[model samples]
Target: MSPNVKSNLRVASASGSVTDRRHAFADLAKNEDVHFIVGDWMSEYNMTTRGGGKVDSNGGSEEFETSFTEAFLPALPYLESKNIKVAVNAGASDTKKLYDLVVREIRARELNLNVAWVGGDEIFDVVKKAAADGSDFRSLTTGKLLSEWECDPIYAQCYLGGFGIAEAFKRGANIVLCGRVADASPTIGCAAYYFGWKREEFDKLAHAFVAGHFIECSTYVTGGNFSGFKSLPSPALSLGFPIVEMEASGEFEVTMQQDRDGIVTVETCKAQLLYEIQGPYYYNSDVVAILDKIKIKQVGTNRVRVTNVGSIKPPPTTKVGLTAKGGFQAEAHYFVCGLDIEEKAAMLESQVRVALDETKYHCLKFRVNGRCPEDPYTQDAATVDVRIFAQSRDESALSINNFFRPVTDTIMQSYPGATFAVDARQAIAKPYYEYWVTLLPQSSVKHVCYIPSKGLEISIPPPTDTQDFLYEQETYETNAPIDLTALNPTTRAPLGNVVHARSGDKGSDCNVGFFVRNADEWDWLRSLLTVEKVRTLLGGDDTGKPIFRFELPNIWAVHFLLKDHLDRGVASSSTYDVLGKNLAEYLRSKWVDIPNKFLDRGRI
Candidate 1:
């Protein structure tokens, strides 16, 4: 995709309130030029709930769609008036219900409406059908249904892709609804149909994919939860919706609601572009897109247009998103200070362990961190906290209350500084469980077809080699090696760069990391920074375990078990998580335009 494409058409971008998302449709209906309606809905967790827990269904429940429905339902009348096509992935968990509701609305209005529902990505149906077919579920990954990882037979469904909607469009569905389709697919399907783009034109498809990444999260492009968010003209009302005007050549101009609140500055767009998304190669489904060297044109107020986008061959397969159970554990922490810290801490821990004996829980665990008086980080800190966190499904609460409750008693009867902290009256208990699952790429699974649009006979070439794929531009350098000296020896960490970026709450914990292009690049970087070099330089026993891991081929880089690394854990615990989080911010700040500066900088 290139930034030079010209799109003179006037598109309607609407915003009102959640209750009037449908009424907002009046803007579309009133505008004769409006051809399509796109809705944004989803969150970082992809789950609707504000907090975490075992939910009723795989993708939370349909009830979670309440906000979306309140906003989307009223749009039905306007959609009928314009004969415009509507596409949204708001189906979420009970997508079928949403789909049925929309279809019913269209029909009851005597509207000539076509609706298609996209589901099956939830994996619930796939697991069930496999069971009915007596096929192993793992075969989805191995191309043979080998059931290596057992799934809740009732919960798994085949991962669905966007191509199915092309088929829906072909079948005369003006409205498309889906569950768990790749985010980029929605934008790609619209562009592919509008421009008569073929699949072999992987470059344009990839460019559209990047465009989707920018605008898919709705308010994200308009400064919602953005880094360094500033005073907005009207955050309390008139929230914006993103708009992408694409030309036949696959280039697009990204903008937000015209005449809406807030300034659509390049900085706002760039900040959104740089949010959690690591760069050079932006990715989704199996497609890896190169965004470096792509041009951004500020052609109009509130319009930061894009063009000259590039694409690469899709991976040989798709990654499945499945959730499964791991195990269970619990943790509780307390603050303590006073003299003979280590000794008092030991006594406190012993007392807690004895409490566990009084209350039988499946498994109990404990740890104590002692503070020295001379430690610079802690002034006059001659203290020891006997933190007791226990793990077990049954009777775990009994152990925590029994063990840590006596700390107050100790302050009055035996320990010093015990009175310094807040009341130890309440014992905080956090329940835990393991969530582990892997994805199987769509290429590995068998599917019936890739549907085309109505009145459009689209021909997608069979999978081909690199030389045959069509891309708008090429700018990626071959993967480079990582420098080892940049990391700390004892901690095996790279000294993070100083950054001026901040997102979310000041103290809120975040999971942030940069994503490279592919597994090949990751492996190359790992080999370049050999364990011997890292261990020798950092002085830490290099088990060579990467604190960071990449979900390969999909090209997502991950830093797991990071809560503690960012200083959200026990005090005096090196505060590495804090450093790691800062390191992520530093990388983002330093490399906004220079694609691989981190690789070139030799050290952190």
Candidate 2:
């Protein structure tokens, strides 16, 4: 009845504050079929008040409770009167409070309403209990103890699956609030419960997952960042949250509320859908849905029919990203001018160092940018901006700021043609954060799986051992075992260019690599990365000698580990063109038939 009540459903996401709720409520009131009013009230910054800290790897804190109390207080009357349900994850840092508030709010009003509260991975108590029960909190990626990282943890929550909310819906909760659930859960829950989709029916879940991805960031999908977005019918009033019309047969159309100010055009929504998604492997706890096969059909100005969604078995583990305490860092900026010129600027900077040597700093570093003698002669003469950085533990890092005042005066008086190109200022340097990649052993985390309306809760079996999971992958029907021998490496004469590939700072724990390609031959390049090449690239030999290769999805990638090949320098820098000249020369000599176009298109 719910899925069929209308061909499409539109949910509205707006501020939980009373003032903002009025704007959304007014829009919802006009649309009789708009099924849900959604709110996002829990972000990391807001959760600290409710005894939740920035460390909650799940998005935001249980601060959803505060948002709930504020928005529901004003919108309840309008929501109930309009027969529209509300779904939100405003329970920021506190799940228990969030659960209690919604339960009590509905019951206090004497309404037997379906208000569901989804719990998250905020398991401080669970971890304590497990520890008391002699359990270990070892890092999955590194076999290190949790205590070794010195993380200032305020919260630790597991990312919840969408199936849990469907269970809550079965219990008749009209509204749903989740803790750190994936942004797509609401869409998945609505589709599975409303349409009665099953486990074997993965296509429907994939459809719902993608629909959620399109609208998860709210207005972004509605025309916010659309490259070709034209004038909206009503820019001020038309933008709203999204909805999916999923059916038993696994077909769905994404649309928003009608009769609003503006339009929800196909081009706009498609742009948002594709924005920020890294590639074909769309991941979640229980499903790894591929986005390549999905088709978007523009039926009208504001609607797109989504079809041909393909689904695959999810990875056994989910990656958790926690921002932890990693000491303090600070930076100071100063502008050194060259009047009689570049040589003068360098001398002035050297004089300031003599002044700094008198002071005690735990650690210090200096970098000179803009108008140095070694710099290219693009500028008329030479003027340089020198930035000095100092870092230490919390207390010591504060000392570096003191140097700013004295250094400013010394440069103006002592150095020739020395004027402050930019005034010297001091600022706090945030910590160099690190990420540790660890698998949540299936034994530790549980997956409670279910189908629509079945009331049967089936726990997905744990994956076989890690080695088995890695080695036993059966190639999907759409993909075949690629024949590597038929493929020929494109060789070219060395173009005398060098490219340097290095790991992103955060990639200290994870393996970050890159490959080369010629700019024009980017299309159809990914097909060249066969299973054999992937295995070879990702594989390790007994000697611990690193072997590297790349698969071309769209770009002809010559992937290799940064540590292995980049001890001296990477083939390229993050800014691809920096080494273009060097790379052209290198590829010409060592490579053959290399897809020139594939390698060229990945220039960032």
lDDT of 2 by residue, 1-604 (tens): 3543434455455532212333554455445466665555543223323333434335454344553565465556566667766666566555546666766776777765555555534545555556578765555334466567555444444555566666666566566666656556666766666666654566667777777666665665565533323455545555665555555555667676665444566545544444433245556654656655556667876777877767776566554333343444455555555444445555756776777643355446555654545554645345565556554445443453455554565755665555553533345444433333233444455544332233444454443422212211222211343443344443332221212122221112112223222333322233443334334433431123332233323222323222222211111112222212222123223322343433343322
How many pairs of residues collide in model 2? 70
| TM-score quality measure for candidate 2 | 0.60
Encode model 1's per-residue lDDT on 285-321: one tens digit a residue: 5356765556555688778776766677765444343
TM-score to true structure, per model:
0.60, 0.60
Query: Model 2's lDDT to the true fold?
Result: 0.48
Candidate 1 TM-score versus the reference: 0.60
- Alpha carbon lDDT at 1, candidate 1: 17
State in Å the error of residue 570, model 1.
20
After superposition, candidate 1 runs with Cα above 4 Å error: 1-34, 43-64, 107-112, 124-154, 157-159, 231-238, 276-279, 326-437, 441-604
